[model samples]
Target: MTKDFTPPVRLDIDHLQSLYRSGGLTPRQLLDRLDDYQAAFTDRNLWIHYLTPDEREPFLQTLEGESPDSLPLYGVPFAIKDNIHLRGIPTTVANRHVRIVPDASAFVVEQLLAAGAIPVGKTNLDQFATGLNGTRSDFGPCGNAFDPDWISGGSSAGSAVAVALGMVSFALGTDTAGSGRVPAALNHIVGLKPTLGRLSVEGVVPACQTLDCVSIFARTAAQADRVLTLADRRNPTDAWQEHQQPPKRLMGQSFRFGVPAADQLGLVEYPEAQALFDATVAHLEALGGTAVDIDLTPFSEAAALLYDGPWVSERQLAINDLVNTPDQVHPVVRDVLSAGDQFTAGDAFSARYRLAALKRRTDAVLATLDTILTPTCPAPYTIADMMADPVALNARLGAFTNFMNLLDYSAVSVPAGFLDNGMPWGVTLFGPAWSDSTLNGLAGRLHHRVTDTVGATSDPLPDEQPPQPLRTLQVAVCGAHLAGYPLNHQLTDRGAVLVKRTRTAPRYRFYALAGGPPYRPGLIRTEDRGAAIEVEVWRMPEDRFGSFVAGIPHPLGIGQLELEDGTWCTGFICEPCGMDGATDISDTGGWRRYMASMATTETRQ
Candidate 1:
């Protein structure tokens, strides 16, 4: 058990695609890696449920009849968190008393099935998805994928292990309070938590409906992104699913990323983790991104609301049956659920009001950066450590994650590096909702820039990306220039693709600059009186973005643009002093949208 457990077998999405196309490995050959994984871990509680190869034979047989192009995830295996339902498999949530479901796959699982991914089995989790540590389960805790003695973080514990051990290509876990993310940090993988409601919640047991997101666990950022974009499908039967507009891509050669102050609790712990994170910041700077220290008071306040405020009521509501009938649940889960009874509806509204105030404060602080970068987890933990004091350990695990869902932000946690103990440490790139794709692209680039290692596989890193015949650049445009709006053809004529339609980082103000052919927005950057103005990032060849920027008139110029995430790119930014006698339109956060809203309001009046 003491022997190091890095799986010799590894699988990555892009590489697997290349392999499938080139015939380096067949679907069946890859599935055999499961046997290797089982042997490597040897009953590591990584699975609360497992599908026998014989049981998966029919799926494998069907794959052989289809062409490689017919199946993107053809023969690729994945694991599911026990909280998510899978047909013919039990959804236990690691609680022995729960009855196995007779039918239906979670919407996310159904989509993966359609993509031709085979499910290995349901993995373990904290009972009812209540804790960050895997140890809370009735089933034994899933050990860290790298070191058996340490904890494999939860509630996505076994899902992370399944991927880390190469048991599957990727795994699905639910992130309520960092369950999806912390495990990835503890067990070297990418954990993608899409904006809330982007992924459907149907067929999954709820932890906290308003805050829960089905997350992906993969070896590389690209794989995680692929799964995320592919899995973000709507289920007609599911009413809770929220369709998001496409993510706005941010364009720039260099970016300015934001980091928590050096004195921050999470940032200061584990000198080595801090060093690794700081080194990553330095790497980004060297690669043309700037990092700035910011006060984390607002973010911390939002995080406190998750456990300290009435939000605990949401968790209580999620398992009302178990709470009312405590005998039906695991002891630890029962205790966790019991706390929810402490709140009333009045407390919920009061918390909401406080959260709104915090959001306003956060928006003000967010106005200064492109994206925010933080350690995925404050520090690592082990099974024994959690058993000693589960609640406190769980709280520490969510030090970074609890606030994200509550604030309605999108984030991606990529493998930054290994800790001094040889366990993994990860960092997350976070931005406001719908900025998922921007963070994904940035994360993909950063993953390649740093580790260059794909998944848990043994394949060598590919050589540098050769220059594209026409390298793309992301450009931010507001006002009559926005897509589908008047004068929008300026970009289409130059072969630009609209990647997303979202707001700027919460840092810029929109102004009705005195005059133009069609009124234009003059984006002025300021210490206050500004919000992240809405804009779209169009991917054009470097030459095209350049030509477009050059044609932009004075007062309306493209400088550096920050997305909701803390990463900066070249976009639209006015001279800080541009507000002279100009009508302040900062409250709107976007020029075109603001003008349209103003026109609508005028009509209504």
Candidate 2:
């Protein structure tokens, strides 16, 4: 790189793709530049095993035929939390004693590599990924991106910092109780802990096997979503990858999101976090969401069970080989994992039963809203402060995250912003299993609502891409069903929203279909002589279209109708025979105006 040439501070996948597409850079040039970038941040503790160019030759050569347009992640550099396996590398879950050589990459890593992403190295993490604070590792804590004095948020800490500090474009992490999310919150990036089993956990070192979800960390929700689309697939061999289909899309752009009631949040002590959360709530409302305060009793209680109850037993099971030699583990992590051995089979069973009960109750509450929004971490803390009280501090970090897998939910953590002290914060959107796509859709929108710049860099987000309307069919309404009219509730109740209010092409004639008190109208396209009847276009979910059409009476049926802009849509049209008795209301532009005139005549009489 030239002395005058400034490298991209944030290797957002899109940014790299655009540069490659425009002939601004190549994979070879980027591979060379990675050396320069990594050299500048040598003290940040970002990696456990960064590969050299000679070591990276095979990985780079694998992208021989791929190009940006053909492969979504073409030439994008990435990192993996050391707990996840990469071929020919040692699988060190941040513990030197437990290192094991892996002959193959993990399932998700294979998929990403196949799509042309370059794996530069393996990153450091909390030993066995057993702590939320990044300080539990034997190698060193993955220090916070902003301040070495602060915590990076772990066990995905180094993965988050790797992306934030521009060492790599994105990274893979494991989330059991906010390991994936808290790091993103603190480091100013995006982390998506998808639905449990939504992405295969085949090669991941299990912290809590049943609860672990392979997660993606990137600079923006859009990049997280891109990685998610490629990674979410069923692995028949991996019992956790259950192959569940995602649920229906949230009604529309509008949604109702739940927040913990005041007493439950307990954020008064952290005024900055509290204020940022309040601002986020207001921001969601501004984006057309209805915020509902909820009783977090069940959720909070479930979070406690993760460490205080028998579920810690699963952590012990994950490292069965290391249990006898406790000295090899980090002191705090060893203490936590050792407690797991105290629970009896009966005790573990009892905890599972209680968790099931909580799941049922929490599921009911989730049903009332599209998502539950919470602070990714209650608050950020310094590395020194966390080390002083490792257990409680680590527990506080998982306050909002520990319940996710217990209840089987999907979540995305997006950057909220930095506070006066220069540390970043984040908010998460989560919902029932299979809500990944919907949650991400809202997450991307909410991300922009808080800040434009990605990660710790100064570059603003690229221009917003206009959302492509869902596959739902568009229908045009010319009568009582228009916005604020008598029958409009039917459309709204069925998840339909007004797209636009425009006019039909000049050749369409309108008629007041001589029906009862619940009146309606009909439109018909004529060859040459009629006005462009006023109409409103609405988009309805494809699933609801059949029932909506079934409700239409005999004379008026859905048929192709031309719009003022020459586009075609499904709209109410009358049968020729029915038009015989129908009174021509074409003189008025639309049914609403015609009805207004009738109301005036009645008042005059």
Candidate 3:
């Protein structure tokens, strides 16, 4: 079978779709190829339960008479973490003693299955999703895809490895404290931990019920984004589910991003990892981002509260019966959850109070930046090393990730580079809640820039990209609405950000309209004689745009105006009748220059 089978080089959503269209591969062929590939990794501890051919047959048969173009994820294969429900499949969560066969799939899983995705199997994880290092599992440690000796970084260990090894196009993993991201860094894949509640956790075993998030593991950020779009559905039945509003696209051609202060960097002991992080910062700068040093004190303090404070009790509450019978749990995970016994109800309230204060501080810092960039994990550790110092080392892996859920942020971890020893490494870009798409877009661009391949595969990165977000619109302002002018606040107060200062196409006439103290300029497209007029382009959330346009007075209205670069955007334009009493100011070049001339005239008088 191995000699006759040749696996597809890439399993990205687009690649799979193209193959299905061209008749190069079918869902059954890919599944058979994956089954053949899995034979070589029997000892890797990547799966807790490998689905039998009978178990996968129904999903394959569902798409038999359907066209590939009918469903968004038609024929895509995905792995489900052992903790999440998959209909009749057993959810062990890496602990055989508490295994339960759920009658229905998770809310997210059902959404994927309905869209024609095949559930390959349930992958291994840290028992009860309690640890950061992958070794704290009853099924044995899941090692890195590149080297079986190293830790895969978990509790999402097997999910990351499956995607990294290209056994599936994507996988579902749950993240409460770095489980999703740490594994991605170690295995070289894209791990997207969307905002809490963005993906419903209706059928998943919870680590900390309030903090648990169903995350996606894929070969590229684009694939992760595609999976997220399909999996994220409004689950009115789940109390914890939230309807996320349309996200604003904050990351653009130029953005400000926060980085941990030099003294607070956790990679001080890992020189190679530190060097890679520095290079990543430089690469972001080259991509039009300004690095701003931010104090990591509040974020670090909040991270400590997750395990050290009463939040651990939430994990205990999630599995009440198992907590009472600690012997059933892995020894390391048992020790960790046992800490919850010491906290009282008072401790929970006090911890919540402290978290609220720290949240304020973090929010203030983020308000000035588009996103925060951090190393996904401090460094890679071997499975032997992880098992030896389980507690301390697992805490180290959560250094940059634990605070995200507590603070309600969206994050995407993408492969950054590899270390000297050939271990993979990655960095995360995170921002306020509902910023999932923006972070994914930025991560995708950065991933392509730093690496040519995805996971451990030799397949080249796909040229086709994820659809760009359209939640914001760009508008150009030539007069009163220009930055520092009287009407500029109208734009700024509506959450608009200045994109750039440029000139319009040399096919417009600029006129100073007859108006009061806060005068306006009128731009008219002229074919015969015209000159470029200076303007400032600003982008604002689409939801706020209607209000911004509604407040415009008389002849000045929003219309498409061509810029010097030939790009058209909504901008201020004038009706021909409004030019009756207006003075031509074309010779002054722009509104700013004309205003300067007026100021000089007033001083001389």
Candidate 4:
């Protein structure tokens, strides 16, 4: 082993790949250096089980003839939260009594392995994944990557610290309440809690089986997007898997985002936190986002339901046998699980009904905005402070995060800034399910604007290529569907936004179709005599295009129309049969002008 083996400054996927291509390092050399680093920090209790050299030999051997160009995660290293399974490794949920070795790796772990990512070890977590603070672990509490005195946040504690301290390129963690997000904010990294059921949970321990989601921790949001794209595969054996859906709403350059009303912020007590959140909102506005104040009553009520309501029963059911013998479990975890016993079936039903009603109201708020911005936690707590008041402090850490999975929203938590004490603070950008890619893209841009360094590393963030715009279909509207027209609501109601106002190619003739209460216009392609009719192009979500097309009446239908810019788009076109009784309005140049002419003629009569 090279005694002075200095690993890459940043363990992000891109930097590692560049180093490998330049022959500056090999996977074996880096792993050896990482082994040395892990040994140096053995007191942090970051890992429950670190793989030995012989145990990791097979993964290194598989990369012998493979090139980084051939694989997305080629030769990259990652950590797995202890609750997730790795073939033949002890699956400890921070509890020795319930540990078991799985015969097969998790569905997500297999996908990462196939893409050439090596797993170094399983990291520690809160016992049975119950608390939001890292202190309840049977393996000793994991500490903040920057300062051991502060709490590392919960359940996914070691996983976030690993990435923050540059132990691995990325790590896999699970988020039920706020396990995945809180840790990232405390440690200064990016944590992406995907839409519920977006990633398979097979071979993993369940916290809340129905609401559990696999999350990714990385130095940057771009890296998280890459990992999510690879791990998001359907698993036949996983009954809770949900397929990714096309976006229902579209976000543009200038978009509206929601912020909790002042009284609901939960940051007034901590002035530093409040100031940091204010700065975050201002930064987003600089990036062309408009802020809207929204009521957090429903969202806050739903968050309270996770722990205070009968949902605690799901935690008890996850490890019933172990809870029966409370001596084996951590005292805090045991107490939390025991609370499940008092709730009866009727209470569970009542909570479920209340949750449904809250979801409806939350959904209505989400419909009016592109995303919501909130501080990941109202404030950070010291490890000593957290341990002294574990339950309440843990609950406070989850204020902005606990409502995500319950409301079926996707969230990306990125470092916003650091507090005076040097501990990192972050903000979460969240939206409805299926908005994962958009949220990630926005998060990436915001992250680059705020900080150059990730975690405790001095290396600057890699320059990311501009993300491809969201998939949308553009349609040219000439009449009733144009902006401010009587039928314009039909377009806006389906999440369509105006792209620009331009003229159709000069090769089309404009017509005022013979119609009733609300008239319409059509454009017919003509060879010799035609005018450049003005049209407003609107971009609509692809998933909504089919329904929008289905609503078109007989005379005008969706067909290709050429624009003045020499581009073709789906637009309104007229069938030859419907033009028999139509008035030739080509001389008027557009529908709006023709309407003005008709009004003039009526006044003269």
Q: Which candidate has the highest lDDT of all?
A: 3
At residue 261, give the lDDT of candidate 1: 72
| Tens-digit lDDT string for candidate 4 (465-548) | 533324567888999998888999988998887767999889998888886668988889987887899999887778888998
Total clashing residue pairs per candidate? 15, 0, 0, 0
Misplaced by over 4 Å in model 4 are 1-7, 321-324, 466-540, 545-605
Task: Quote the positional error of residue 445 for candidate 3 in Å.
Answer: 2.2
Candidates 1 and 2 compared by TM-score, better number:
2
RMSD of 3: 4.3
Q: After superposition, which runs of candidate 1 have C-alpha atoms over 4 Å from their true positions? A: 1-9, 18-25, 248-251, 266-269, 322-324, 452-605
- Sort by TM-score, top down from the best: 3, 2, 4, 1
Candidate 2 lDDT, 1-605, residue by residue in tens: 00111345447777788898998888878978878877766667878999878878897787776779998889999999999999988888998887778888899999998888899899989999898888998888778877767889999888998887767878999999899999999888889998888889998888888889899998777777778777765677888787665254453557789998766788754778788988899999998889998988999889889998887888888877544577877889878877786899899889999999999999999998878989898888888898898988888899899999888888889888767676888999998776676677677788888887766656566544423223367899998898888888889888686767899989988888776667888888899797899998887767788998888888889899888888898888888877767888999999889999989999999
Global CA lDDT of candidate 3, please? 0.87
TM-score of 1: 0.76
Tell me the whole-model lDDT of each prediction, alpha carbons only: 0.76, 0.83, 0.87, 0.86
The TM-scores of all predictions, comma-separated, are 0.76, 0.85, 0.87, 0.82
Better of 1 and 3 by TM-score: 3
